[model samples]
Target: MSFSTQVKNELCRAAMHRPCCIRAEAYGALLHATIFSHREIRLNTENAEIARRLQLLLRRAFSVDCAPRQAGSKIQLVLEHAEQLGHIFDALGYDLKNHVTYHINRNVLEEDCCIAAFLRGVFLMAGTVAGPDKKSHLELKTARHSLAGEETSLLLDLHLSPKMTRRGSTYVLYFKDGASIEDFLTSIGAPRAAMELMEAKVEKTLRNTINRQVNCETANMVKAADASARQVAAIQRVLRTHGEAFFPERLRETVRLRLAYPTDSLAELAARFDPPISKPGLSHRLKKITELSAAEEE
Candidate 1:
């Protein structure tokens, strides 16, 4: 299953011990649902689990029954009766007839647990998280601008910094930082999903570190091989122009070592000296040989 779906499914199993928390969660779900107004209360979802959870939440919170009906690939829970809709609005402390502006009932979410439950319900209805393998992102979308603003404030109250943007007619509240997303997931009762995200992040960092190390090593090997090949060619030219017998003892010894260990690194060749020399000393001798060969060619 997708990461978003996995998180939602886990959240579905979250326990609501208090009646207040249950009502808060249900209120969040209804507010963000496809249609939540006085005339009609409807929820449409492709996830059967969300549909089921909403049905149970409504019944538990307000004793309202909403049987989900399958519509093609989607499931919908609808309550059209005026009495049932009025009861839902009343239970949520929303006065549809008298209130000019719609706002979240902060009283129900006074406790931290209730706030978490409410956010969880919002996510189940209209939230999505990108797979950690791709990017770090978690977003909740709603058509109600006022609801989105209230959610941002609620998150801030919980010490979470969320960004808000408008997408067409919808307002989106999102968390971009990986740590923030993980914390949010954990707070909403998806600890397993949060752990998975962290694991994926660690695995990606490790893989990148290994690749950089391999590239550095490979580059060093190529540089060494190129230097060695040039050194060999220069030594061969010196020998051809001035026979080995004409060279001094030190130069002759260096020439012999180079001819014998064409593939050995400078350190390895240096170690083979009668009295081992440092890598820099060996390199200086090799440079002198190259200068002599160049002079002979000129």
Candidate 2:
């Protein structure tokens, strides 16, 4: 399957059992989280599109009115019914455990790259200004901005760690800014999303690995078949060119029948020839043809 299809399939499985779930919203959050968690650099156009899509999803899924605030850099969702929205998402399987996982193993580094972009967008859109902290990594600055108009600053630090694999690469994300990761997760209802998303990622990776193995096997079979066809053709060409004029009428017929069905064993070929040629005799004919072909090539 294509990479997009694979990601969709993983999403489908993760979204299973929560038909009433806010699929688009949750997926948007995941996508946003993914982009925001990793990359340090991105184009403005790309960031805008992600923000637009995410805003649409959140609005559609949660019925929560949200607009791009902070000079079109952050999204401001006025959640007077925060508890109600939380309950709905919780019912729909939104949790921190669901979001933290390596969803697809194929092109892992690339996948992480996408996730980082997503997280960056999410943070910016969620009214959190992201910039380099003292350490020069991404840090979420949620202070009462002139645009936010007296909202308290909420500080959170998100970080991604590169992991080496036997054949490729992978990544993991953490909220380095939180005193307790669990507390932060519980507050945001991320565990359910985290757990489901992580499971989907693992399952998707396994499927990809299996597909690669299957493709390799099929390619090997095709190669073997082609080689066998060439070998049989070579034998026939040698026999026709070098030995046809010397063979007796009956011997010629017997040899032709054997070569016509090259896969037949010597015993099967002998049965078709009058007086029943022995296995050794059949072997001699084939060996002689091979020798002729080799000598001609040399």
Candidate 3:
């Protein structure tokens, strides 16, 4: 399934309680997530107005600000208003903090339908050709590590003038025939090994994103739990700060576990029990004793 579709399904599952609110929120959130995941904002031929359209769409969707710039011939897009964008994607179940945009490109050789199909949609613009024309003279060549250079060489070989285009602010190869030099790779028998390596790189990038997102979620949970524990600890610390007063045997054991292994989780502390205690049992016992001690003081 497409990432967007999977996200929609997940959102629907999560919103069984309030379908209407989820529908509205999920639409906006999905849009934000997809846009943020895009490595670059590209436009060609009829898509020349894409930058302007996206900026306006973002303004409407997010009610957040955006800025555009031109450095020489290249147009730059900056997301000046990230707060709402961040919030929206977060709500959509994407860990935006762990998501990062990275560049991925590969020269195509030998018309793989999968690749050809991917690029056809990728390069499609407002008025561009619906798909590749079989009669086009351009052919793709296999050249690894130098997408721009390989493209430049291929165009030079074909006696086509290099028409430069920007993938966002970065310059990439384009040709007068309304297709990128990358469009020619498959026609020239580019190496399969090179293409496989490119695929590997992209796979690694996706895996890293998955791992980072999981880690971020785990870290956030730990931080929240720790904050609650620290608040209770702070009160106890104040009570016991001045001098070591004798706590009841049970309370002493609880206090000892809390002190000796300050960073250990409640479960780990419980496991240290001569007869292992359940986390809830340890917690309840500690709470009751603390209350009793507070009552004695009062």
Candidate 4:
């Protein structure tokens, strides 16, 4: 299953025996579902776990039994009966006959646990999270603009800064950063999914570090090889134009070492001297040889 599905399944198993928490969760689910109003209450989901959870929440919160039906790959839990809808609205503290527009009822979410349950319900209805291997994105989509705005406020009240945008006909409340997504998943009772996101972040960071180190080492080797080749060429030029006997003793010794080990790096060549020289000292001798060879060519 996808990571999002796993998160929802984990949330579905959260214990909900408190009456206030149950009502809060059911209120959130109905508000974010496919259709929720005075006349009709419909919830649709492709996830079996979410469909099952919604049905259970409705029954447990209001003592109403409503079963979900499978249509192709999607499962839908629909409540169309006026009396049943009225009962649900009554339990959620909404006046079904008078209420036209839906806004989050903050009074229902007085406690932290109630808020968490409400958010859990919202996720089960319309939430999605990208796998950490891809990108850190968690969004709740709704067609009702007012409900979206209210949900954004609710998230802000909980100290989460969610970005809002419109996608086609839907309003989206989303979190992009990994830390925010992790906290969101944990808040909604999906600790395991949050932990997985953290692990993915650590793995990605480690891989990037290793790649940079390897690239640095490869570049150093290339630079060292290029310098050795140039020094060898300069030494060869001196040997051809001016015989070895014409050079000073130290210059002759440097030329002999360069010609003998054309592939050795400056540090490696320096180590071969009777009393080892520093890399900078060996580089100075090579520079003199190159200058003299250039003068001869000119």
Off by over 4 Å in 1: 96-101, 246-298
Overall lDDT per candidate, in order of appearance:
0.88, 0.40, 0.42, 0.86
**lDDT, candidate 1, 1-298, per-residue tens:** 9989989999999886899889989988888877777888889999999999999999999989999999999999999998898888888877868632458889878899889889999999999999878789999998889999999999987889999999999899999999999999999899999999999999999999999999999899889888878878877876776788656677888888988898888899999998999999999998887777677768
Model 3: how far is 5 from its true place, Å? 39
Task: List model 4 lDDT by residue over 223-288, tens digit each.
Answer: 888977876786677677777865678877788888899888888999988788898998998888
Screening candidate 1 with a backbone cut-off below 3 angstroms (N, C-alpha, C), the clashing residue pairs are: none
Model 2 C-alpha lDDT per residue in residues 169-248, reported as the tens digit of each score: 22122233322332332223334433433455567679999999999988976774564455577657756677665444
Highest TM-score, which number? 1
* CA deviation > 4 Å runs, candidate 4: 244-257, 266-298
Cα-based TM-score, every candidate: 0.84, 0.31, 0.33, 0.83
| Cα error of candidate 1 at position 57, Å | 1.0
Candidate 2 lDDT for residue 83: 56
- Runs in model 2 lying further than 4 Å from the true structure: 1-187, 242-292, 296-298
- Model 1, position 64, has a per-residue lDDT of 94
> Residue 286 in candidate 4 has what lDDT?
86
